[model samples]
Target: MYQYKNNILSIPARLLYQDWSLMSYDTYKKKCDRKQLIRTQQGKGLGNEAFLSYADLPHEIKSVCLDKIGRPEETVVINLLEPFIIPDSKASAFFSNHRTPEGRPLAEPKQRQKSINCWILNAVQLVFEDRGMTGKMFGKRKTRIWQNISEAVNKLDTNKWNHTLPGAAKRLKEKYENYLKEGYGIFIHKGEGNQNTAKIRGEVADFILSHYALPIKLTIPMVLAKYNLRRLEQNWPELAESGLYHWLYEPEQERIWTLARHGKQAWQNKFQHTLSRDKSNWFPNVYWAIDGTKLDWIHFDHTTGHKMASKLRINVLFDVYSEKIIGWSLSETEDHTDHFKAIKMAVKQAECRPYLLTYDNQSGHKMTRMQEFYNDLVALKGGCHHAHRAGAKNNPAEQLFNRFQQQVITKFWFSDGQGIRVKKEDHQPNTDFITAHKHHLKSKEELSPAWEMAVNQWNSGKHPHFEESRDEMYQHPMSLREQLSLQEIMQHLWVTESQKPITYKKEGLTLWLSHTQYQYEVYDGDGNIDIEFRRKYVGKKFIVRYDPDAMDVYIQLCELNAHQEKVFVAFAEPKRKHIDIPVLMQADDKMSWARDYAVRDIEYKRDKTAFEALIARSGYSPSAFIESQELNIKFKGSMPKKQQQKVDAEEDEVLLRM
Candidate 1:
């Protein structure tokens, strides 16, 4: 059926015509083999015998050969497409002799056997197809043919295949016949060696999951104990603790287990999918996040004359866009006062009010006073304020506070580890050492400066989204100014001394606030007592609002609107005291005194002029009445008593008419 010359196997024309129906080998070779359609081998002693490398033949031609020889095309295609290399024939021996550097077999025992089986199947198929032998050719003849094909496969591609084929002739024959009958499935091991023995029954698995996945956080051991008590009654098989653990802690069940055992809040904080907010377009003063956190450092308390029992609270107003600490205050307690100071500082420094303020529902923030300011500021800017639910995990201000604690407080030796959620086992401060060196503890005074330094350092740090530092980003000029005058902002921030209406007096609007007396009088923009304002508004009632720090400057006067809300009227300055001595008088004082004197002199002159005009309007003369009286006296001296009496009577009548 075939011939070999110079070790190149070739198919004879008669066999090709018998198997493939190629009428002329020369014509076929010229049209197909020469064109590389069928791989051809040149043999030195070839004549009428077509030199061919069976392994290198075209797949179609190999399929025809396999069909003629009664072998499946699948196995033939696999063998022809990736024919056995030279190393394959001795693969079993090479694998058995070779060992890893550690002196272990190159492949796992089972895997090695699988590779050998695969090779045995390929080699037997190659022998039948290449040697044109079949199972019908039995005993030594078939064995001899197998030996020849295996030797050739080993001599060809020595570097390509790294496998072993080791089996008796009988075993090889059995595998080959089985492979042809049942295809590739025969190689797949169906033994109990690789079976999953630890898999629990479906009902048992459901019971384990139902008990293990719960909010009470039962450990595997605890869950196992509970299952043990119940499994005996339910006729369940004994379970290994390790297997139970593996089943319960599978990666696929992690989310379900966490949610069930840790509760919704914990799951949300730790595992919920969250999206990042894009704040690239946000500008400073457009959004402000305010929150307070304890400083986590023990400091000396001057008021108590000893080391503080608690940490100081730090209230901060953070510009969300820039992440800048725009304003902050250190206090023994967090209250509306601290919030007021912080917000006031922020507004003052930014020269603008925030368009939106984000805060949590804390006692300090919920004060009617603070809430009103928040509402009024947003109202003025046509923006809105939002109050986050208390203890929310996603508050931006809380994240900022966390960063502050980590980046700032952790730098100090006295800082408490409580500020950080995750800390080294040995990170906590030594209380005994702190107590022994109590004098070294920082006082509120020292901490104040230190806190200020930390704030400056934070503001100087690089911003997350911008190339500049936090302060630089915040200080960058805004495209559109939301600038509010300091006074205007103060109107909202200042506390109301008394909501009850009080009448304005000459001495100004007087009220008792925080155990101190404050007197405010109407003053014009030029710092002069506004006499016209005083005349118009004096004795009228109004509500007073004053800045505690600026009590000497002015107070805001407001009147009740139809809605019973205080509507700002005007600014009333602290009442000015007159300078008794001229030498101590300022220019303004002298001017005020001169205006008062001038007004008095003008009033006196006007009153005298008004008297003369009144006499003329009466249509009577005082000189005429005096002349008549003198004439009557003369007549009494020269004439009779009756004539004198008549003259006196006529004079009296004229006087009465006047």
Candidate 2:
């Protein structure tokens, strides 16, 4: 507590020190050594005799004290005459307990503080005016009071409050007059609803928005300049360019502006609402989605030293369930061949058949040959196929391709990348660096390894729907019914178009294929000929369909249906012949001979059993059949009656021989 007596303030030493240091009692004692303070008992000085001196204190400190208490000289005089009273709150306090006439606290503390400061300066002016201080004296008094207040306000936290200098007396007076007229309501921030006060409004704002929101996307300054020319003709005030800019960029208007400036496709790709799909229940290899995208990388041929601009497209086949890239093929253009190669790779990599294959309806995918190939795949693998419309997002490969491009392709520095719907001119690669490093550019063949590495990395990552890596998820076993051997899948990958009919002979079927004569024997996964196939199609002309890459095995003897579709008949192996000389026979020849003899014995026994069974069923003995055949059953038309009767008698004898 502070006390005034004998023209000296009898302030407690701790109280004075506490106020000066703005610290707790115990902290003041420990950190500042309160016993060493002036007028302390330990110093042998007059204790608690600290008197106030306004001139001795800094200007900022004086101003702050005046706002908190009152003018220094009068405050001291009042303290001496009557007990001093503290203000409801300190000037340095941020949150004021005072409420406005509207029963709401001031919306902005800075605004309230600014109004209070102006009021203080106005009070100083009134005092001078009441005393008849005019001209220089009045000006000096007003300046002095404001300077004191501002200096003290500077000591306080000025961040939240405006630190307006004391020289702006005219502005301060105007603010004080507004406060008197409007009361505390004037301190309420203008941001609450005062944006209606913006200069660009009505027809001018509509004109600017309409012009700016055009697909041309006219600049704000350009629109403003045009509007100003119109205003000059109409004798209306021209709006400032910055004012129009601020209004146009407001949150309420920006969305409409952007949507109109850009097109619907851009809006849909970038800002449209999306629904997430849950694929956790899906099985690997049951559903495959394929799509093609132009790679971001720049490729050029080293031999020709010319860039192959926009010549590369990567067709990717991925398991939609596991999110694993099973296959991908790179080509100079989007063609049916690339799609076929990609499908082939996926089949070989997964070694399984898919139940449903989804692809985009690109021109390459709609080719008659491609359609037939897809039909063949479905027929062999037992699945349906679907082709989505252009720009349809139903294909998972589209999303997977985007992820691969952004996450994997962007890591390569030379990759020329851009966001979706971004103009190429807005985001282009460093052409100068590319030109300087032209020698380092890779050809299509060289770029393949990089693509392979990226695929591997993508497969190695954890799947979003599973707790395992994509490769692990893809490796999980699927139904055996949907599985196929690599050879079986490859057999259907090649087109089954017949070159020419070939005869099925006693040894094998022979055809002139790929500029060479080749013999393929009916294998049926075992020996040259099974009993049923030999009996049904022996000596018949058939078409041979086989994959060139796997010509050693997987030859198919097929028959063409009414629709020109290949109907599989039997699988065959390349015919192998062996020399009969025992001394000259190699190990392979001996093995081949052993297999042939074993298979032939089985076939002979089967045929013999079938022959005997047929004879028994017919109730015919072999001796009886021979005796019956000895009698003549045929007679000439001009033969005598006795001869005819003999012929009839011989027929009866043959019939009765059973």
Candidate 3:
């Protein structure tokens, strides 16, 4: 009693092997053909041996097989006769009648599937249709669709089709939405009303639809809608209180929040330590670097005169170790004397002798007096040397000046607190108003000193790199303490040597000293000398031991004749101070500063013959002689206006000449 169920064929009962007997006969015949057998045997055998018919084989293989065999029809027949034996039933089922319980037919058996380009086109058409669009619409209206398809095909060829498909779909959607949005022209408009209060929300839905590539959860319309709802409730309160909207719009607020969060994190990570201790060798000796900078005086008392408007030069010396200002001096002039005074003050204040004192190669530094001072210290064995060749980068002292200008000077405004009372402007009609406000603005005074004090306070308060205040760090006790007084220490640190004179030979009346020749003669009672008796390079000035009773001016000269020439000898004027020439010469040996090293006998008061002999032997140019005199005087105190003007003019002339 077999019952049929809706024309369904049951597996096994329906006899899927109906053609088995015929297939076996055909397989037996095929097995006899060697060509067909070899063809079936090719490739790795998974299990089943399903043969490809010669007629069904690709054209490429058929052509190659025919060429190899040398006869097209025979080769085809031989290849067709080859039989491929099926494996065990279970293995055969893999390529044959494998089916599930649903009893649907398995895939087409052992026949290579033909590639259908039309079928691919159909699948593409179906895809477009599913999106409520057509291929024509995609290609004609949106050119990117065709581009995307080409790109997808390239991806498919490269085996990267899996990733490209989804991305391409997303990009296409975004492009289409953007096109429509731009067509409608929806944008955020700013400053539309009085105090920017009028708000118009128009075509927002269309905008969202056009810009649909944006994440639905992050859509601008959704955000704005919520914002507007909130604004409605707060509008009255905002208008009543201070009349300003405090809430910042989207992107700007987000940026500010992000920066603040990151900034706080960075600040928390910062740490401080003692820079001096971190690098011990950085400050081994007390190297005080000295320099001066001019700071402008903005507020000047007009009554002090226009000269008061001149800038002040502030000299400062910094101890390189503690970064403390060891010395400071303020002067109205930028001269060598002012610089020396500053240096003296700084030395007196520090009390600790700096092993090295460095300053720029300014005229003041190269002056004879200053150089003499350095030489004197060197003579005393001080390890002192001028940092003559330091460039801006090598000198940290100059950096401090830069810091002062940048940090302090540039930040303040100057003002004088003094008030003034003056007559008001006379007006024939508005007398009452004019009389009511009769006071005048007061004159201004310099506020730089106060500003400087403020800077000192600031520097002492906290250091940028160091954990402690500058004062605290400087005052902190250390293992090493300086043992020598500042001056003595400077002397100990310097290298010194005696200068040897360059001499020249002359026959007649002059003796050569330092390349210059001077006539040697004993002054008569009237401080006069016989020009004919003058001794030249005679070594005649040598002291001779004589009996005290027989002491007399010894004259040694080659006298060819008794005729005498009266030499007008200039004696030290009784009222004038007598400068011991020898003492002055010895003073040159230990110069406190090079500025005071005098070149002797520049302007001779003796006879022209003596002067000419001195000039010729010394090789002293008149210009150099004049320069030496001009350089020797130390100008101190404030000069009168006329004198200062003259000095300034002279300085300009000198600079121009240079």
Candidate 2 residue-wise lDDT at 650: 50
Writing each residue's lDDT as its tens digit, candidate 1 over 1-658 gives 4444323444543455455674465665675545653434443374634455555556787677666654432231112323332224444555466533224454556446545556646655654574333432221364365554444434333334444443344444566678679754465434222122255546576555544654456687776675676566668776656667655554334434554556556544433322222233344538899998888887777778685545688899999989998888787777776787888888888877677898888877876667777887653646778889756786889998877877777677667655345476455666676678778888777888888888999999998777899988887776555667867876677876444678775346787754567666676777655655553465577877766557787788888775668799998876655554666666986776665435323422433343334334432234544566577676657878788667644542454366
- What's each prediction's TM-score? 0.39, 0.35, 0.27
Model 3: per-residue Cα lDDT over 357-399, one tens digit each: 7788777666654675555432134557585574556777788
Q: What stretches of model 1 exceed 4 Å from their correct place? A: 1-285, 309-311, 379-382, 414-428, 464-468, 475-481, 485-541, 561-658
Tell me how candidate 2 scores on lDDT.
0.59
Q: Which whole-number lDDT from 0 to 100 does residue 184 have in model 3?
A: 15
lDDT of each: 0.62, 0.59, 0.38
Better of 1 and 2 by TM-score: 1
Candidate 1's displacement at residue 428, Å, is 4.1
TM-score of 1: 0.39
Instruction: Give me the runs in candidate 3 sitting further than 4 Å from their true place.
Output: 1-285, 299-308, 375-382, 388-391, 415-455, 478-658
* Runs off by more than 4 Å, candidate 2: 1-285, 302-310, 376-382, 418-421, 424-427, 465-467, 476-481, 498-658
- Show how many residue pairs clash in every candidate, following the order shown: 4, 2, 34
Give one digit per residue, the lDDT tens place, for model 2 in 465-525.
8899999998787664456676777556875434366766545676664355666776555
